[model samples]
Target: MPKPPRTRAAALTATALLLSALLAGCGDDGSGDEDLTAQELSWKDCPAPSQAQGGGGSPSPLPDDGTWQCATMKAPRDWDDPKGDTIGIELIRVKSSGDESRRIGSLIFNFGGPGGSGVTTLPAFGDGYEKLRTRYDLVSFDPRGVGRSEPVLCANDQRLDAYFQQDSTPDDGAERTELVDSTKEFNAACEKNSEEMLPHVSTTDAARDMDLMRQVLGDDKLHYFGISYGTELGGVYAHLFPGNVGRAVFDAVVDPTQNAEQGALGQARGFQRALDNFAADCTSKVEDCPIGDTAQDVKDRIAKLLKDLDSKPIEGIFPRQLTQSAATNGIAQALYSKEFWPYLTQGLEEAYDGTGRTLMLLSDSMNGRSENGEYSNIAAANISINCADDKPRYTPEYVERKLPEFRSASNVFGDFLAWSMLSCTDWAVAGAADHPDVGAAGSAPILVVGNTGDPATPYEGARRMVQALGKGVGVELTYRGQGHGAYDSKNKCVQDAVNGYLLDGKVPTAGTVCS
Candidate 1:
């Protein structure tokens, strides 16, 4: 048992503090969507069990029935409204089993979209999560106005298709205006059609709903897990219910205090770092690599392809041709996983021949566009919640100024990647009052996971978050992996570490590192 390197251990400890905090909203981003400061309604007992018809105020028992139930619980239309209007919550409850029978409580999982769906997760990606299912009920649902729960739909299919298919990067004034107009149009339509629900979709409000769910499920406290955007949602819950927090794990954490504008800029810088990693990894394989001898070469090749797509979108992909939108999306997608950079090389290779199916597939995944011409509207939700979640430091001209640096950093994906900031420029709601500092609260030890090379969420953000939260003394779990969420892995080490904590309330020792 040799001592860990002093400087290395110091850095590790600092990293831990930052990330544990990042996953929570310590800073003020007043977007009611993320107001961690607001005090929460106290946790109460669950409603009478599904089996209990009526009782003399006896708390209900858990539904032992094997089948998981998809049901709606009710919350307030507005947190401000103590009793005015009620909103129904859609939930999926997977019951626990066997020795794990006497489970602590329901484990609420949110899959990160301010627009993401929880219903579709387990059957698809929870392959690594079945064990947790055996101990506690694994449940998730479309958060208010998201997915199957009376979702927010803006346009009819065709126009919606156009919306998803629209170019993210605007080259000329007309293009930028179109992007702006399109965004405005979507916002207007969403407001006009989904007006009643827009304000209610804020994260704090949803955290409140989660407490209600905890009550209905009879959990005295919460045992929760959130990913990506889910981390924000989880932080909101923790902030609103610091007393009720228990064994919470925030994987692929999001920095709460940084408003949407900051988030986008950080994400842009992040993707560039991820791309650089991918390029280096790709070229190391030489023949298998798609980019050239250097990471810069790959970036240059990508830029040339995007510029070409902007002028002449390559046809032959699917319902729509390979537009700059597709190319931008494709490049961004590859930034998430080093595994995909090979495809990045192939995409570049094909586009260099004046075609781009390889790249379009990458774009399709990045945008969450399905084969049926359907999309998750994640990009839309990304804009909606992000813009609403926080106020941007509006220096409109700063966008133009940052162009060179962003491009040099990201090449093909810079503007489309960079312009994600623009969504906040015209935000309807300002951010939280102050991005509160997390980890200041002396609650249970929080677990912060960071992939050394995640593109969208980025490792630096995680480092900053853990550092902020840990203040140099917290549990920092390193996942030497790539992509947005690493827990999706079937890998034994990650599984063991996470499962041990959730099931046994164990927190890995400080400076614990995993590959």
Candidate 2:
């Protein structure tokens, strides 16, 4: 999840938010193109403000931002059978800030949630990327199963609201059974609602749509920036179309090689490390701390609080009660950036006071819940895409067996993460394609960034990506900061390195550490 610009600055002003050597034959040459029928995009003003900005049922317009124009691009539902059915991919493009004659090219962006909306995000934080926008027309799209595209809506608002609050940590056999049952119900709902679309909404499908965008835009090669889960999509694209890969940067990188279980294990440990860092920082200023004076004290108190909420929820300023799942999500959301740490402090303080408004809102933002109780299709889309890309869903018995390992990885958030991965156990996959090793061998040197303290996509994932991309194809840049994303934070070294790469095509030397 991305921190909106306002809160991002606040967190990073308090904190700070990498890469290595040039490999031979890694530079981009004027690329070749296979002649294909290219579609054209007709730009128009976005929909009304209420429909666009408000979490309404209809499609969102371009957030009333004057500079952005919205368009819908047509893509084959199943690439292998292109003529069978087609779907629309929502796109928002902000033209270059400089003169059109001087414009370099379009830079595509994806902001991480397998379900995250580039339509909403670009408007929320576009200005911060003045360097890129000034030179290239910044383009972002809602992939096949997200946002204003042909979305995947599982449950309605009321049902989803209740589901979001379900207890994440099951304490007994009955609780575990309930958890498994709930997972089945949710997956069944998604299948019933979006059976035709689920099979084609994986990262590979999205990458094909991205290539369509490139063809329409008349770009000879692809220039892209992807964060967190988006990096997974970009990596897939790079491997599929190495010759089309241009200046691509995968920040807060995800390792494409890991299966669902391995990915979850890494994330469990990563989040635990982040919580420890947050606890250590929080204890230093005990007066503002909500739990205790030391990291272990904070950990124990939080674990107890979650356990307490599983049985008895706290009614906060909102009409809904805060449950263990929502509270865990709330805490995890704030862990994305240090600037949000104070907000986490404030939220936990309120939760301790028996009012959970702040924490609830935090969780709501992470899930894209609106003030009026409307929901984005993100939750459904996130599960669908993850399940589709990483096949082999775990059975109840498998999950129970792995429970101990997960708890050992993260006593606080591990069980929740582990059980949640089982949502696709019963969901059908139509000819699901196996993910291959993605090195993009013939592509230009791709920038792979790692944040030493990032929780969601751990730092080691970046190293793994570098290795996957082979010796020369990957450039490693390290940020000694705390956050899920590195480029948009307050670190001048990181900002300079990224800006320099995007603007001048200057690749940082290997092992470049930005402190």
Candidate 3:
């Protein structure tokens, strides 16, 4: 559910445009391997993003007429063997606008997805961070096995279209077998296409790369901004290089304590809570709720629509039909942000009339499919990194057994998330651990922001992260709001707290609340 838990927190941002117009070798041993860190980056004007990075024109110039710079930094293919082959980590940045004398080194960002290409993302949302840019260069990069960083390719566009279309929530034995076979085939394709990369794309390896990136950037401490899954990455980085951390923020925080199953379960509940909130909001409006007479009625109609779509799909974008799985995906995507709620209302209204175009567009956004039908490696990288980081692998039977529990969590999302546990079935690489180790015992204070209505990472994760980051390290800030993250909501209160912490050295009082 929520596109595999650590799925792109920016999906709602992408979906809105569709509605309108659409490792290892590289760990901190304290020795700081001089060779890799010593190499200089050759920054130049950013070129158009590659297909793997979600193809688009080059980043537009900043308000001050400064262009976004792009570069590739070499990192170990495997952190366990730092001297072995190297892979390029694609990076993008815009230098500070404030006085050079007041500049505070580079402020790096990783905006979730684990698969998201920060090179493209940073510039797309660059204007929002202009204030921070006044004191620091806003920089972001594609981790190894993602985007232009020697990306982990699996099926091609046509194959992916078919792959995503297949039913993920199976009912009978025959359907279950088909789902398993399809999942295995997808995993096999990834291994065949990226055997070498599959083993090294774990979170730990990426953490090491960040440490190397900090050294190469000439920053004595790594100043960072992490959102959603990026928060997990930030935690791992802090754990690895406690002494090297500068000011860091973790928003829409992921619980470092949960294993894959627990994480999925948490998302099922979170999405369900968000759905309930959506229903209540719609019904409370002055005008009649277009979708239902009451909040419960709205949810019931959705459940009925899904059940009907399972057997008889509806006409979607020209050649495709909207199947139950795709509709569910689209709904999940819409639930990510409250701004997209109106779109969800309209999509549901249209779906009730036997048309499915809008919902399909949202599904396409979730899968990283563009208007041109080309796909970024988002889904591929998500599965690859998740399978490598998580140790447990589930069989169809296990999912079947867990269905009731999942269903009880959320009538709309339960079975879907329960079935997702099989994504790592027959994965080529052995997983690294049961759960990530994020105990940064001696690290500098890291601001952890959580939104109460966040469907993906959930708000409770903020508290878990605070505890896991160890006492005095994670300063918890709560935003009683909707959507996946707090900072991007542009709520002045949340932004003020975060900006105060990052722009200055003023960490908000621990347990600060922003509404």
- Flag regions of model 3 displaced more than 4 Å: 5-9, 22-34
Q: What is the C-alpha RMSD of each candidate to the true structure, in Å?
A: 10.9, 7.9, 3.6
Using TM-score as the measure, name the better of candidate 1 and candidate 2.
2
For model 2, what is the error of residue 269's alpha carbon versus the real structure, in angstroms, after optimal superposition? Answer: 1.1
Give RMSD (Å) of candidate 2 vs. truth. 7.9
Segments in model 2 whose C-alpha atoms lie over 4 Å from true places: 1-36, 48-66, 286-290, 430-436
Shift in Å, residue 420, candidate 3: 0.2
At residue 338, candidate 2 shows an lDDT of 72
| lDDT tens readout by residue for model 1, 1-515 | 00000011111112222223213001111222422223333323323222101011222233344444555555666778645565555566556754655577788888775665564443234445667866787777656666444455555546766875677777678877787787777767666766666666667767887887787777787788777777767766666677777777777777766655455556666777777777777777737554576767876777676787777887636557888776676666655545455566767787778777766666655444544455554444445555455545443367677777666655655676567656555545565534434542544556677676666666655555565554432356778876665676445676677888888888876556677
The sequence of per-residue lDDT tens digits that candidate 3 reaches over residues 376-467 is: 88889988988899999887888888999999999999888988899888999999888999999999999999999999998999999999
Q: What is the lDDT of residue 80 in candidate 1?
A: 86
- Point out where model 1 deviates above 4 Å: 1-68, 100-102, 286-294, 338-346, 393-398, 427-430, 433-440, 467-474
Using lDDT as the measure, which candidate wins?
3
Worst 10 residues of 1 by lDDT: 1-10
Would you estimate the TM-scores of all the predictions?
A: 0.81, 0.89, 0.97
**lDDT at 210, model 3:** 93
TM-score for candidate 3, residues paired by index: 0.97
CA lDDT of each prediction against the hidden true structure: 0.59, 0.74, 0.87
| TM-score computed on alpha carbons, candidate 1 | 0.81
